[model samples]
Target: MNKDIRNLSDRIEAVFPKMVQLRREFHQAPELSFHEEKTPARVAEILQALGLKVRTKVGGRGVVAVLEGGKPGRTVALRADMDALPIQDEKVCDYRSKVPGVMHACGHDGHTAALLGVAEILAGMREDIAGRFVLLFQHAEELVPGGAQEMIADNALDGVDAIYGVHLWTPFPYGVVGLRAGTLMAAADSFRIEVIGKGGHGGLPHKTTDAIVIASHLIVNLQSIISRQVDPLQSGVISVGHINGGQAFNVIAERCTIEGTVRSFDQEVRQFIKQQMERVIEQTCQMYGAQFELKYGWGYPPVVNDSSETTRMAAMARRIVGDDNVWEIPPLMTGEDFSYYLQKVPGCFAMVGAGNEEKGFIYPHHHPHFDFDERVMKTAAELLIRSGLGYLSADSPEVTVGNLYR
Candidate 1:
């Protein structure tokens, strides 16, 4: 490693303990989407302590901190989500969530801590920083019409040349950093359907319009939209995860509700599936003489990485983790609100491996038992700072757009 890089590595190691403590504090007091009252305040206080100009409650309980470097150049934004899931923490650990039915099962705690660590590192080297750094601690990433949209509405991307985000992913083994040039994650959309019918005795099926039966048919036909309606070359998913209906075994259900998620990488395919699903529900209900209501909510879009930005970020990753540990993998089915940031400006969202089966950190995100190796937070922080600095120090426009690195 270069002498400067080695020195930065040492600095990051020295702050690793602080990062762990921050992550633990967040884990113990996990907050849910849009209801993150305390999380944003805590983030604002920390950023203020770093001597950065902080903006509180920019958009839906988010905090934005701006650090102006000594030199003049473009502006780069680094983001971290600070909300938790509704799942109750099942792991018996010291830092487990104290709030019932709420936990940071998605590793947002680690992401927040890592971004704080990056802030510490970059703030210390303000003289060497050529451009300004914008630190965004976002909220409600797990919910639809994500916090990113609100933040952008409040001018979060104004005057920003580029943006970046990181996720502590458990699917990959520890020490691996995943990156890709094109779409890295799928678009997530959800749907809810209500089949309404007349109730009657279960024994006399001919006298009643069975809502449960209609819902069952609708569920099965929804899958056909993905497999039969969509082109085979394209990928799509229509999964019905929830079903609620009848109260008694001898009574026919008057209404049944079904809820599920839709995921796709292509916009055309995503729209096609939505239309097909509505068609199936309408036609199926008509066939059974039942009334139906359907609601489709569009969530996060697919996170598409700019080729130039991804290539430059990958080069920085190789420098930190060696060539073998850096991977350009295929797109995943998971959705992220970071796609919103990418929609406005060029950015790359990298997945940092935090999974370690030996240490019981193998569970997937949103799982009650999900946990991650804290050491990866150091790698995450270092990578963010390295990418930010690399983009700033280079003088050429191509370098800023992610062609050549300093």
Candidate 2:
């Protein structure tokens, strides 16, 4: 590591306590989706305290902060999502969610706190900073049409050369950094199928079309699209997360609603899944003398990391943690809105290892029991800050002027 970065890393240790406090506060009073009323205000306050220009209520409770460095160079943006899931907090720690059904089960609370730490360290070194820095505290990443798209529409990347973001992952061991060049995460899409049929008395089953039975058959057929239709080598998932239908056990329901998500790395496969789902639903409903309505929602695209940016991030990660700790992981079917930013700029999205078996922080993201070793927050902050500085210092031929510093 260079002397300057080594020194900066040391100073980041001083803010460790603050980072832990911020993360705990976020975990305790977790907010859901677009309802992050209190979180954005706190983010803005911290950014303002760091002497940076802060904007609030961006893209629905999202916050953006700008820190202009003394030196002139390309601008880099650092982003952290700030939304919790609707799952109940199952942990017994003092920092457990006070909100009954909202929890930071995805480690987004840590991501937000780490970005705040990055903002503090970067603001302190503004005089030495090679370029301007944009700090994005985004909201509603857990929902469809993420805040990143809204922020971009609000011109968040108007003058940014490159952007960077990270996910604190639990599957990997602590201190390891995961990076990939192309298609790091899949594109996520959702669909809702409402089957309409006739209801009748429980004693006379012949009179009812039976929407529940049609929905059941539709669900079983949908699995064939992935297992038989889609290529075995290609990746795709069709999961039914919700099923709403009848109230009473004896009543033959008139309507049944099925909601689920589809994930794929390839656009063709994504489209194919949607097409097959609609076809199966329509055909199955028709055979059962029922009508169906399909509501398909397009979501975040595949997160494809720029080759140059991925290479640069790998180097930075290796410098911070050893080379052996920096690893190339396979692409994931999971989705991230950060893909929206990469679509507009040359950037890399990575996963920072937060799993520590001894610390009992090894649960997967979005799980009710999900948690991570807080010490990884420091490592994440340092990697982000260093990568921003490094990207600003180096110029790549692949980063075109059309997408940079607009």
Which candidate has the top score in TM-score?
Answer: 1
Lowest-sum lDDT 10-residue window in model 1 = 396-405
Off by over 4 Å in 2: 395-406
**Candidate 2's TM-score:** 0.95
User: Candidate 2, residue 106: CA error in Å?
Assistant: 0.9
TM-score of 1: 0.96
| lDDT for model 2 | 0.89
lDDT tens digits, residues 1-406, model 1? Answer: 1345568988999889999999999999999999998989988898899999999888878899999998889999999999999999999899999999999999999999999988887788787677899998999999887798999999888888988788999998889899898899999999899999989999999999999999999988888887788889889888898999999999999999999999999998988888888789999999999999998999899999988778767777777888889988889999999998998999899999999999999899999999999999988998888777777765424345553322
Residue-level lDDT for 12 in candidate 1: 97
Q: Kindly state the number of residue pairs that clash in model 1.
A: 0
Provide the overall lDDT of each model, using Cα atoms, as 2-decimal numbers.
Answer: 0.89, 0.89
